[model samples]
Target: MKQKQMKGVCLLIAGILFLLLFFSFSGIEKTKLLDTDGRNFEKAEVTNVISGNLSNSGSGKQTVELKLLSGDHKGKIIQATSSQSYLFGAKCKKGMKVIAIINESKGELLASVYSVNRGPMVWLMAAVFVAIVVAVGGRKGISSILSLVFTMLCIFFIFLPMIYKGISPILAAVLVVAFTTVVTMCMVDGITKKSVAAMLGTIIGVVFSGAFALIFGQVTSITGYNVSDIENLVYVGEMTDIKIGELLFAGILIASLGAVMDVGMSIASTLNELKEQNPQMMLKELFQSGMNVGRDMMGTMTNTLILAFTGGSINTLVFIFAYNYEYQQVINMYSVGIEIMQGLSSSLGVIMAVPVTSWIAAFLYSKNQK
Candidate 1:
């Protein structure tokens, strides 16, 4: 018990140190960027709102008093204007928070409302999610949360920074995915046969999914520019020399990793328990048992991956349907093609992970018994 406590303390300290290092590197990068425009972005809270009519437009204008929450002019009160249009306006109310942009181009400091602030709401939702996970999962939940944090750190610190430095995005993603798989499996299952099996299966599955996405994406001529923010991404790519085209497969790999990891771990852990309970069972029997469990999980897990992708772009589909797009046009559209590739590739990962995990677990457990 004391050893476990010591290990946990060491891990906590290491996590804190890693976070400090990550933020230090991020701050340096931010400072290195050239700020040609003398504009500052800050969060602020609305103290008051006054509504006024727009001349000959049937729209209204909202004049707000904001108290800055961050940046050099923190805690300073300023007035900003917002248009009350349903299409392109931020409808801010008193007590609501907003993002304010400070412009100092013409020797005068002027502030304007940028958008509604959703950080607090997002934080609140995250807190609720953590609370539920902890309540339901207990010790395992804590490990899960730690793994999640580590994965996010890897993405923000290792993956993004590497890509920003002109590294191949696909290679960086592969490295991050491999690191995440090992860490997450170890955290959840300890350094046991199950963890080893799950990690191996997840890596294989992710690689297969990534390769499939890249090959088919090329075959179908679905360029990464199909996405909504490709122009912005292209601008960043021009600055950093990053291969924006490979981002499609990189994104598919990362998105598929979690689902593959889940399937891998579930099958391996189940088979490990089965082996423990029935030591007399033959290796073939154990493998068959694992297959049975995998078969049961295959349907819902595949649906989960497909449905998740579908849900993300349901609005696009709705728009297409509303416009009465022809069947051929709908299927041939780049956006639709991308979504299909993502969904199918991820589902393939989940499908392949089951057998890979089961085979590894069966062999490992059989060897252990021998």
Candidate 2:
């Protein structure tokens, strides 16, 4: 079979297996009404719409009489209210769906109306994303989406749980990165020699980024809890054996993985393509091609990493500027300062990954092509 044919078959089988695993282990359970944990109150069914009218502010408020939909007190009618807050203006209307959390002892219900139901939207968006990906990239696109799904599952199911269970954050993070790299590469590039090169490159880049984060963290005497989120994690760690500093380092490394992967894959793929195009190319010429592509990618990839951080922290930057802190002090402050360090460190990882991966691929291609 042709290489493309084999890759296509492998991708299809992998996708089917992924879907099977997803549904088989979805952890769905039917719960009894009164016996369920965190069961605050039963879902209330609206029985009578007593008053549906606009108030002085032209906002619609509805007084709904509701009864318990399930459980022991299923037949009792009680008053429930749904109103659009004035800040939302007159857009609120009657019969708009809302949730009512009831108190059995007090026979009272608190209602909050949402503009949209997230449950349906989440599933809908996921389906749409998958459809669009498959439509655009075909087999490659499917692989990319599967890799992304697996990555998310590993983070949520494996990494987050391990961290919550008090495992060392850095250790958990390393495991997550390793797992994600394998899964992502396999799906994106298939189980080929090229994919293997990409995987190796990813490992090297990831380790480099992680080490830099650790070394910089120590040299700067920056506490793990310096950042607002990590500071909260410190309190969480106090309740468990999880070390905040290690976890913080793990986060820094993991955060750099995406960009590192980008650089690694770009170099590896470019080298492979060059080899295929000119089977007689020497190691020097191949390495030159890889470096040329890397040079182009390095600037944009690093900019991508930095801009992402900047966009996320723009609000914090604005707040600091508003406070009138001196420029030196503002930049030196730990709030946005750590992000700056992190961004630059990750950028260095991307810059370094290109050459290292390219060199490895250059040597490998020269040996293998002949």
Candidate 3:
């Protein structure tokens, strides 16, 4: 009971620290080009939306009365004119939330309706997810949620900031992965030998996966510029000293980290349980048991990675198939090749994680017995 209380206290302290760090990093200015002279964006609630006749462009004009929810003009009621295009514009309605841009440069407090405010909806969905996880998973669910929040914090705060500050993208990703793995494993399994073994295995598997992705990407001529919005990223890279070229394998390493950690944790946990059940179980027997468990996990985990990547790029595949492209042509396409690389590299990580985890678990558990 005392141990549990201490663990809870530690988690509470960590959560507070994480929140402070999140807000501090989130507020840091990221853009070097934007020079706004007293211009700000604010959230507003639409009290009334008056519609005008449709224009020749098949769009309507609206006079929206908004109550400011944020910014220096909070609680101020203002009227804003908005043109709503039939095909693309967001039509505001009564009581609907919207984002407003405030321009003070003209010495007039003018609020322009930008778009519908979707932030609340996103937060609502996240709340539902957390409630369900906590309800079903109980204490373990809480641990999982904490780990998830910490992982996101690491990505958003540590990884992104480091990359933006001119650190190597690959090195930043590696550090984030290592940090996430250690925190996640410790949260789930406490400070046990199983957690240590799992952490080691996860780190090894993720590193190998990154190495494979880098080597194969070079061999196949699949540069990181194959994805959408890469040109814009290249432009940003010019402004910032970011090496956009190394982002591909860095992406692969981060994407595969979850599956690798899963495999490692599973193998280590199974070995620990087996050792606890039969204290006299030989090291060889424990190792074989872990292998058996890992083999079963490997098949499904590999398929999961492949299907996940395929699902994300299903539209690209459909387009290629619709064009009746030859297999050679389709495989040679940069987009398709990159997807294949991601799937295969991630699967390799999951596959390698099994044995790496099993061996470590076996050795550690055996030593614990002695």
lDDT of each candidate versus the true structure:
0.83, 0.72, 0.85
Judge candidate 3 at residue 209 and give its lDDT: 91
User: Order of candidates by lDDT, top first?
Assistant: 3, 1, 2
lDDT of 1 by residue, 1-370 (tens): 4645644664566567556646744642432335658888789999987655565563567788889999877898888887756554467778988888888766677887777787889999999999999899998998899899999988988788777766788998998898878777667766677889999999999998998888878899887777879988787777775789888889999999999998999899898888888788777887888889998888999999999999999999899989999999999988899999999999898888888888888998898565
lDDT of 2 by residue, 1-370 (tens): 7776766786676557546645543553422223433334444555566777876765687676666555655666667666656543122333433345554435444443323223557899999999999999998898788788778887776676666556777777777787678668877876766777777887778788777877777777776778777756665677665577676677777888889988888788888888889889988888888889989998899999999888879988888778887888876678666787788878888888887888888888888654
The sequence of per-residue lDDT tens digits that candidate 3 reaches over residues 1-370 is: 4646645665566567556656654655566766778888899898987655657664777778889999888999888866677443357788888888888865678767777788889999999999999999998899899899889978988788777777788998998898788778768766677988999999999998998898888899888887778988898898886788888878999999999999999899999899889999878898899899999999999999999999999999899889899989998989888999999999999888888888888988888565
How big is the positional error of residue 352 in model 1, measured in Å on the Cα after superposition? Answer: 0.8
Once model 2 is optimally superposed onto the true structure by TM-score, how far is the C-alpha of residue 49 displaced, in angstroms? 8.9
Model 1, residue 144: displacement in angstroms? 0.7
Clashing pairs in 2: none
Where is model 2 more than 4 Å wrong at Cα?
1-92, 99-116, 229-232
lDDT of 1 at 15: 65
Off by over 4 Å in 1: 1-36, 54-60, 85-89
In model 2, state the lDDT of residue 143. Answer: 77
Candidate whose TM-score is highest: 1
Worst 10 residues of 3 by lDDT: 81-90
What CA RMSD would candidate 2 show? 5.7
